[model samples]
Target: MSTPAAAAVSSADGVAWDLADLYAGPADPQLDADIARAGERATEFRNRYEGRVAELDAPAMRDALAELEDLSQLADRPLIFAHLLHAADSSDPANGALVARTAEANSQVRAGLLFFELEWLALPDDHTEPIITDPAAGRFAHFLRKGLAFRPHVLDRPVEEALEQKSNTGSRAFKRLFDEITSGLECDVELPSGPQRLNESATLALLHDHDREVRRAAARALTVTLRSNSKVLTYIFNVLLQDHNVDDQLRSRGHPMQARNLANEISQESVDALIDACAGANGMVQRYYRLKTRLLGLEKLYDYDRYAPLEQQDGRWSWDRCRQMVTDSYAAFDPRAGEVVEMFFEHSWIDAELRNGKRGGAFSAGGPADAHPYILCNYTDRARDVMTVAHELGHGIHQYLARDVGYLQSHTPLTMAETASVFGEMIVFYRLLEGSRDAGERLSLLAGKIEDSFATVFRQIVLTQFERAAHAARRSEGELSTERIGELWMDANAPMHGDVVELTPDYESWWSYIPHFIHTPFYTYAYSFGHLLVLALYATYRRQGPDFVPGYLEMLRRGGSASPRDLVAPLGVDLDDPRLWQRGLALIGDMIDEAEALAAGRD
Candidate 1:
């Protein structure tokens, strides 16, 4: 484990992303002036085209979009910078305040410009045709398509403005309250080093400890903390659900999930199919857990043992070694990708170190076309940490390439967003697997990668199912009791793990620690979708070798401009087919088979 001091140095060692590139800093005089200037631009835009959009010709319409893009670009930079920094270190009250203020300012800017797109969408297809034909409008195709998709839900200007205004205090406020309450919980766990306060992330790390006592203590502490805070979380859930219910009714959306599907730009059918496939693979997951039980020499495997390290190994890789491993893997597959990823390490773009008050987990944010993407991670030199570095860098490189398309089109939907990151991880994992010289190392590498896949694909599906049950129960009746939530979580996990792993009574409350449930409802399935898609894609790459790079890069470049089906069609991958998902599952099955065979031979 990395010392807190080392983690702090890791946090500060890199440049920590020059959002100053966006605006010098929050304290910059120019940044203050730009905020004022953005307000001026919004006023100018409304006055110029608010009620007159119908009269504009193709050239005028194209010019209007260009102007809107410029204004959006200006308003977005500081807001992005503020939010990125805030997410990087949420424990800082100052960063949190900055995020709140920036969100409000951006919402105001959005409210001001709402008329432009609303009016634009009201125009007839014939009137919009010439605008679409213009070379300048090419970049706005994705934006225009999104605008059209929302036409059914788009309201009159006054109604839209009212919704926007209410949003800050409604769902957004509840989200923040939930985050604060959850993050504030301090789990006092007794460790070898003595009793200490552990945040959610730190407590999660304890699950991987070789000592079962530590894992059990962490689990119990987590339950105690969440149970204490259940009332607050219940209130937060009720408020957010009510907000969603009202919004869905207003927009005439069929279901809450329908709105999410629309936002993801994926059909409900696709999600349903994906979920079904995951459900069918529960047995395979059970088998893997059974193997893990034997490997760990446990009489009965508990939920906490899911992530236990193999053989209590203290293997740690330096940051330098991790960088080389990831880059070398990428280079082995595609030099261009390797070259792009190398820039992140070389130019000090990533903040990859764990520290207190720093946000937990890993994410890539802030590639707003005008600036390079920045990644934040709590790196601790573990093998998993290396995989995370590759994962995030994949997102950074994808953002870097898509930056050429301009801001609106550059942002991919959440479903497709995971494609590159997961693929990057596979690249590194496979390279390492091929280089393993001994059976023990090979088994460890394979086990680690499979565990990651199961977590990403299988575990996330369980989460999605859990959320579905929780929301459904809430909507049909009312707020769920803490016990009720735990029961629902257990229901989702029981079949997924089967009889191989014992779901202890305390394990049910594990859902309480999952930030995704609070932060993004039903968002967990996207991880599963992305994982399976990448697994299948990686399988193809193994067969086709270097020939796959161009097709993959082309998909990345398309970004949000194309749908998932169109993006993957070039590589002959069809997401709509259940069999494609099965292919990914089959690959996972193969890994399990290999592991079983190796263990049998060793015995």
Candidate 2:
């Protein structure tokens, strides 16, 4: 959820989630006991099932799968708690230690279960197909079919186990290092209020301030701070890049993106089309920015001014107002969607407090199947914060509906995961648009929506290109230095803005702040995937009206039980059609046109 600007700042103060429902703290004895229980179950399951997958009948296989799910639920409790703690404050050594310990324990547990997947991969289709096809297996059938997707990439059991074991001290360690480094950073910038120091999140919020000078200083503060730290961040990127490439090469993956496509259960062809279509539509983005240049009264829109608010709306939303706006919008869409939003607020399932050491960005994380999803966002009282509330609660509601499907099937792919969240934002956005009585408010709403669409749709696709180039360069050209990586970043970025906006060298280092490049290579495209998918789906909602509600709900409830193609096909979505993507991008273009029309009248 890391964006060009931080999602973790607020003009309005605080409300933190009560983790007591999961565990009071890392010190909770229940957390320790759950870890031990999961470990013991993992060992027993391994002893009973290892080397026996092919011999198991359909009934036995169902029981074995259920046992694995139980073990996963146990492991998730402490794992999620540790994650929440570290997210709340990455600088705390105790939180860091627990996160490390949780990773180690979860890895070991997963290692013990590794034999099941490897043996399943070894099973002939003739032997395995009938078992998964059985109606009694429920959603597990879809789960098994999806697991078979990695058949080409799965290694020998020992090799798979070794990778899992090494990942704790390897990839996981690097992620912790990244979190600590970024969270520990502070920006010193002069403001109208005089000299002020802020964390990455707060400092980034300044970039959106109405004052151009304040925005300029915030941008400079960010560039100078990140540039000074580039040496270390660059090293982190290099190691992470090499680590992924080596793993992919070992697995006989054809390209860096093959693994992601396979994991997403999507075909490579579909992904290729997506990247190409978005790149083609990048011209619309350039056109929109040219409009922005006039609105901002700038000869050229610099990177700092890219997200500058067109005009500030006076007043701020209180926390209660955020909750009410989001929940009411969801309810307006459907009572079922609203129920989940209510549950999150009523049950303390969100962490919206502004804190010094908390991480930047926003995300909705699901717990074990029976528990509620938890949202993490830094709520500033800006109008955008209202949209953020709607967006994440969309995810929270999705997780809630998907939960009863069981753990393995409940997790959606990266692309489908954004559907509910984006859709939720649309509901609130349209509500706001409808309620605005005057052109100025309408212009503000339209501008904000268009800006967000650019970030989620166009900008993310560009980052995907940057990631592709960086990974390829690292593989072929040896380790990439800060300068080289920055060059690759700018090379991918400059084309989208064309001559309308400037992509300076300072903005190059901005790439270092994105957690996605290190956390999940080739992951940025999912933002584009989900955004476009939802826009297309939302179009249908407008056309079909209430008829669309049931189909949409069914799609969310299906969760990861089916592949992205299967899940959306029932909703009449032809994902492979380039027209769908074009349609979505055109929606953004329409917004730009509207803004241009409004601006002309204002003159």
Best by lDDT: 2
lDDT of 1 by residue, 1-603 (tens): 323222312322443555566666678877667678888999999999878988876567667878887788888777788777776666788877877887788889899989988887888787776667666665675577666777788788989987887777778877877666664566767666666676666676677677888888877777777777877786777676666767778888877777768878888888999999999889989888888888888899988788887657776777888888999988887888889888887776787765455566788884667678888876765778788889998898888888777777788878889999999999888889889888888888888988999999999999888888887888887877778888998999888888888988877666765667766777888898898999889888888988988989988987878777888989979877779889999999999999888778778
Error of 1 at 53 (Å): 2.8
Clashing pairs in 2: 10-380
lDDT (10s digit) by residue, model 2, range 3-91: 23333345445567878878878888998899999999999998998889988887788888988888888988898989988998887
The backbone clash count of each candidate, in order, is: 0, 1
What TM-score should be assigned to candidate 1? 0.94
User: Against the hidden reference, what TM-scores do the models get?
Assistant: 0.94, 0.97
Which residue segments of model 2 deviate by more than 4 Å? 1-12
Model 1 alpha-carbon miss at residue 310, Å: 2.2
C-alpha local distance difference test of each model: 0.79, 0.85
User: Which 10-residue window in model 2 sums to the lowest lDDT?
Assistant: 1-10
